[model samples]
Structures are given as C-alpha cells and as structure tokens.
Target chain A: QQQVKQSPQSLIVQKGGISIINCAYENTAFDYFPWYQQFPGKGPALLIAIRPDVSEKKEGRFTISFNKSAKQFSLHIMDSQPGDSATYFCAATVWGNTGKLIFGQGTTLQVKP
Target chain B: GAGVSQTPSNKVTEKGKYVELRCDPISGHTALYWYRQSLGQGPEFLIYFQGTGAADDSGLPNDRFFAVRPEGSVSTLKIQRTERGDSAVYLCASSLNGRSSYEQYFGPGTRLTVT
Candidate 1:
C-alpha cells in the first residue's frame, strides 16, 4: 500500500508567487513527515519537516502545514523563484523506529520567471 | 564529513547479466537504506540496514536482488539476470538513527540500464 499520497504530478507557478504541494498519509504510525527537493541529475535533499505535535512549521520561505485529524500536510514556498523549479517529494516514517520511508509519487514544479 | 555516495553513477549491462551497485554513507552514520525510482514514479523502498545487519528486506523484489552491509558503513546491491524492466535509478541514503527522527541524506543515484 502507498502510505503517502501526493497530488499535482506537475505544476507551473510564476516567480514571486506561491508554490504549494499537498500530501496525505494513511499510516497512523508515521510520526515524522518530511519534504524533499530534488534537482535534475541530483538526489533529493531534505527541505522541511513536521511532527504531529505542531500544527505547522515555517523555515525561511518554506512552510509545512500539518493536520493530524486530516492526515494531511502541505508544503508552501513563498516568493517562489525560478531556482525553485524541481521535483518535490513528501515522505513519512516512524523515526527512531525504522529507517524505511514511504514516499509520495512526487510533484514536478516549474517556477517560471 | 560528507553525504552518501553511490559508485558507477551509470551502468549499462546486457540482459541476463549480473550487476552490483555500491553505496558509501557519510562518516558516523549508522543507518543505511536502498530505494529504486522508475522513470516517472517516486522511489520505492528496497531494504534497510542498521549497524551491520539488515533490519528489513521486505521491499526487495525477489530472490534475484540481494544487498549486504558487511561493515555497516557501506553497502552493495546485487542483481542477477537483469531484466529490461530493471532499468531505473537506484538510490542510497544514510541517517544517524536507524529508525527515528533524523533526516536521511541521499546520494546521487546510479542509473542502471539493462538492455
């Protein structure tokens, strides 16, 4: 089963605008949720993460809004720039428990200037 | 001192050939993971290792796929009788914790093409 599900297989946003992506998880055991950003020819890198304890987390221009009841979370990029054009993947795992991650299908975002 | 690294960034082999992909994790990291990403899909978990032993191998596709972490710091994934469907980017990751809150650092995946 796909533990996490993501939407918008591809997206196009204008520079200086907001780029948003959403994900849902079915595994209640997942306590740690993280989003990764990947560029062409490179592996993914951690972007932002959130725990169920918090409703939301903001780091710089990136924000992760999580809802425990809804089993949903989203990544928002403020003032999205062309440099932000890349593939984004949302993942869930029960950290300190098992290193296995359930990754979403991924969203290919294009921020146009 | 560095991120995870995968050897033979690209490999092309004939069908039915055997191939092995290697991974080197960051210094001090104790957990390692293997995943495969097809052309347009997200990565699929394959196996996981903690210390020098495998904690999980349920994701492995079949008996033909095997992995080992002899020393716990590095790993190798071996595939026998490679099939065309096996072509994909295989990724390796490392984390400080075997199963907890630490972020997993990824390596530039090795693109394996079985022709």
Candidate 2:
C-alpha cells in the first residue's frame, strides 16, 4: 500500500513562473514531512521540510504548505528556473521509527527558459 | 564534513550471482538507513540500523536480502542468488540520530543490474 501519494508524475513550467507539486498521506502517525530534490546521477538533496505543528514554511523561493486536518502538503517554487528542473519527492515519517521515510512516487519537473 | 558515501557506483551481474553493496555513513552519525529505487519509481525502505542493531527491517523483500552494520558506521547490503528483479539503485542515508527532526543525508546510490 502506498502510504504517501503524489500527483502529476511530471510537470513543466516557464522560467520565472510558479511551480507547484502536491502530496497526500493516509497515515496520521506521520509528523515530519519533507521534500527532496534529486538530479540525475546524484543523490536526493533536502529542499524543505515542515512539521505538523506549522501550517506553512518558506525558505528563499521554496515554500511548503501543510494542512494537518486534510493530511496533505504541497510545495511551491516561486520564480522557477531551468536549474530547478529535477525530480521532486515528498516523504513522511513518524517520530521514533528509526527515521525511515515513506516516499511518494516522485514528480519530474522541467522549467523551460 | 563529508556526506554519506557509497562504493561501486554501478554493478552488473548475471542472474543467480551473489552481490554486496557497501555504504559509509557520515562521521558520528548513529542512524543509518537503506532503500531501493526502481526505474521511474520512488525509493522503497529496505532496512534501518540504529547503532549496530537493526531497528527496522520489515521492508526487506525476502530472506535472500540482508544487511548489516557491524560497527554502526559502515553498512553492507547482501543479496544471495540474485534474480533479475533485484536490479535497482540502492541508496544509503544517515542522520545524527533516529530523531524525527533530523534530516537524512543520502548517498549517490549504487546501481545494480542483474541480467
């Protein structure tokens, strides 16, 4: 069973436009939600993360909006650039589960300049 | 500081062959995790080690797959009598502890291809 589900397997946006990706989870036990960006041939890097206590978090141009009641979270990238083109994965984990993450299917994002 | 490192970035083996993948986590990190990712799919949890002991290994596909972190720093994922379906990129991650707030640092991953 896929505990975390992500929509839009792929996305395309013009340069300087806003890019959004969404993810949903069914496990209420999840407390930490994080987003990872992965380039080809490299490891996934931490993009942004949010705890259930916060409704939203913003860092630079990346923002994570979390809805605790809906069990959903979304990532928004303002001024999306071509360099931002990569695969994005959303993950969820509980507090004491050895930090093992349950990841979404992933979304391939492309920003055209 | 160096991030997580994985050896043998790529490996190709014939079916029924045995193989091992290695991962060296960050210094001083006591929590380590292993995951497998297939083509066009997200990473799947395989096993987790907290200090020399496996804290969670329920994600392992079967008995043929096993992992060990003897010293709590380096981990080895072993596959016996490998099948073609075992082909995928094996990823290793580590954090300061198994706490929820700590973010995991992932390695480049080892791509295993079984013919």
- Highest lDDT: give the candidate number: 2
**Candidate 1, B1-115: lDDT as tens digits:** 6779999999999999999999999988899999999987888999999989989999999999999999888899999999999999999999887755368899999999998
Tens digits of lDDT, candidate 2, A47-80: 9999999999999999999999999999999999
Chain A TM-score by candidate, in order: 0.97, 0.97
Model 2 regions lying over 4 Å from their true place: none
Measured against the true two-chain complex, the DockQ scores of the candidates, in the order shown, are 0.79, 0.80
Interface RMSD of each candidate, angstroms, one decimal: 1.3, 1.2
Task: List lDDT for all candidates, in order.
Answer: 0.92, 0.94
Q: Where does candidate 1 chain A have its weakest 10-residue lDDT segment? A: A92-101
**Tens digits of per-residue lDDT for model 2, B1-115:** 8999999999999999999999999999999999999999889999999999999999999999999999889999999999999999999999989874368999999999999
Instruction: Write model 1 residue lDDT over A1-113, tens digit each, in one string.
Output: 44799998999999999999999998888889999999988998999989899999999999999999999999999999999999999998885677688899999999999
Worst 10 residues of 2 chain B by lDDT: B95-104
User: Predicted candidate 2: interface RMSD?
Assistant: 1.2
